[model samples]
Target: MARNRYSFLVKLPTAIALIAAADQLFLGTAIGSWIGALALGWILALLLSRPALRRRPSLVALAVAAGFTGVLAHAPSLLGWVLFWSALSIAALMPRIGRFDDAWRWGLRLLAHAMTGPLAPLLDGIRLFRARPRRGRPSSSGLAALLVLPLAMTGLFLALFASANPLIARGLTQVSLPSSFSVIFWALVLLVVWPSLRPTRWATRIVARMPSADIELPGLPQATLLLSLILFNAVFALQNGLDLAFLWSGAALPEGVTLADYAHRGAYPLIATALLAGLFVLVALKPGSASAANPAIRRLVVLWVAQNLLLVASSILRTLDYVEAYSLTGFRIAALAWMGLVAIGLVLICWRMLAGRSAAWLINANALMAALALGAASVVDLDASAAAWNVRHAREVGGRGVELDLCYLSWTGPSSLLSLIELERRPLPPRFRDRVRYVRAEVLETLVRRQADWRSWTWRNQRRLDTARRLLGANPPAPAATWPGTHRECDGWIRDDPAPEPAPSVTSESDPVANAVATTTPPLTGTPSR
Candidate 1:
């Protein structure tokens, strides 16, 4: 009873502050600078509501930093929002995040918190109310009954008086009540912010009730494990040997099989294989298992893991070669990062086996690596980087790369605007240069319109616009009178005729240009950036 009362009282002020903050920052306003303030407020509210959090200033600072990173692009992204909020929630709920917590446990706790957080304040209030003693006084239900008649009679008399007097009726008519939407909006704000202000320990309690991870499962027979390791090693070695010849040694692939085919086909599948191998090791060679103890099996496991690392390296090389052949994009960059993580994970698995480290140690190490990657990703704009890379390596720019992929650049939105302007200034064939300018103009128009409203502004886009303006000068190229395709494919290629018609009906459905654009797989649509 005492604890419930204390908890409710302590959190009430913080909850009210958050409600006001949310009302000011989020209600009826576009998301921009408000994101950072709201993020910081959440962290601050957590600290004030939970006294223990105040002592961990470093952790709190980390949460603040992470939350702010989400707004670095001047607008919050899905990833940014996730990192910002998750960092605060994890910091508040998982007290030993850096030291003792693993990803699986952290994820479980977060899931629990999210599921129960919204109802926490209501449940706490109920408990507090129930805990109050009646002691010969009217209980809560009786008190409600006591007020019923006076409230009803006052309402009844007021209605009668309003019926008899025009002035009273007019006053009653002028009295405004909150709209249903307003009530719902406030309720939603309370539901969303109150949970973080008074985070429930129900998640921790649930996690505590989960079964221990130490429960032993039946392990693979030593002989079966040994045979599996040998066969796996042999198969992996064969693949690595082929990669050594075709990828590293520069031996040509068999006729009709281009290097691009080899590189593209192997990159993702190899990572999947490595992941499967990691899972197999976890299940088959857990610490204290017979196969993990056998000298021969240990040797085979190390060799297999080493081969997996080599496979990961091959996959990385494959992706790089593919990127070189095609063009870089955000997804490819993430894939490369994923391959690197897989390599590190394989190393950790080997280390765990060799050093006799616990599974928890390995899981924690990998989780730390993953968290750092996500944190770094939150702050860095990969699309911008990809745009810059493509512009630099573009064949039109005299680099030995593929032709400038204007379609992809357009899909990347304003992030590619400055890059497109740079490409426009580069020495290229006259027609292609015009195409580049057209794309740049469209992107610039979108950017200028977006920046015109301060609500949608971000420093990154503003800087890009400023830089592009400096480069393009007062008179920038205008958008083509017609779009390049039915959709703004921005490929800058249409019929080979002297002049392609207007965008709406320029090309018939059977036109080769239309086919080319339509055939471009994974058709991209949507405003490139917010």
Candidate 2:
């Protein structure tokens, strides 16, 4: 086996670091720290795969920009979490493969990159054995060195154990050294431990650069194309018609049907069906096929694709209606963006089939579209966005929405600081009011707590805390009041003194929204404020 010294240097640490970070038992599960570790591995992978980032402006920007987005994300959000891992893998592989831009194929190629590391250490062992002299017996001096070293270690350890020093005696007694003759342990280590220790070179310029020879694919038959399009259009029409009548026009569902049930059930599955339809269209109506050339079939394909687009529209409406009753979330935002991409992809598929674009063109176009979407998602702090939407649309607020989900809102962490502030200011009904107060207080204290260090600082967190602070400072929030029969766990509303009475009006920004505060009458006669 050919040895790559430089590659060995890069791969070993990278493999160890990645595997170690993923080993939750040892590292524990801290998302920020875990992602931070992966970020280092990403940089190593990029430098290993493409050393010439300076000369490659686009590559440099892609790497550096991705680094910022992943690292400085508002802690770890739903969108930020996915984008963070994906951006790392894509950054490592994009510069290597230019032929097929499919992410699925690239992911497979990345897995293949991982395989090369396994036998590397074994190769070194074999090479060393072969380089030795022709004698079957080992050299006297080398044999002595090996034997003497272990004996020396044993003597030193035994001396320390028997030493008068109490610290050394206790340290040696507490440590359990592995058995030297543990064949089972050695077997397990060789079979498992060794592979992960090795790292693979991202073989782009070598194996990846070689172009695969192409075979001429016969055009899809005329009959098959027409028949497939006819069948697909019929199927799509049925689905779309149902969606139009019930979803778009707000026709009643069968008895006992709620809007949320109707909307939630269809949102995800329809997107998947639309994606499959797009794939079928690509295959059945490949460019230059006899069916594609037929004007009548082309028209039918357009009609069918239009129906699929409508299906996408229905899915969006379904999700939006669902969100109105439910609250916004990271996955929900991603799902919305994903449905949009599917819609855009269907349009692109139509364009390709009509324009007779090459396969390469379709792949690259789709890849570019995906890259743009991911890049946009990376910078957006989804936790903050979701929190803001949920708080603004809460039933207590003026917007049409569900009762506040205080438990979930709390889990969103400091990104929801401003929204928690807004929730605190709103007058909630007695049942949810106390929970909201508790959640808001918990959220507020966490955000304003003493800094652990500069390492914990992030732009999203900083900006949000600043905004929450300014709002709190402008008007000291009312103390959390408890209704009769409500138990106080931690008494989060404890204050040094009562809030100051506000003057009639004060000079502030002219912005209506910024100056706005919801007026709420206290309905619950609670115990006097502390």
TM-score of each: 0.82, 0.68
Best by TM-score: 1
Candidate 2's TM-score: 0.68
lDDT of 2: 0.65
Tens digits of lDDT, candidate 2, 172-273 = 789887565444444433433333333234434344554432224566777777887889889888888887788888899899987667778988898888
lDDT for 163 in candidate 1 is 100
- After superposition, candidate 1 runs with Cα above 4 Å error: 27-29, 57-75, 94-101, 134-182, 288-290, 479-530
RMSD of each: 11.0, 15.4
Which pairs in model 2 have colliding backbones? none
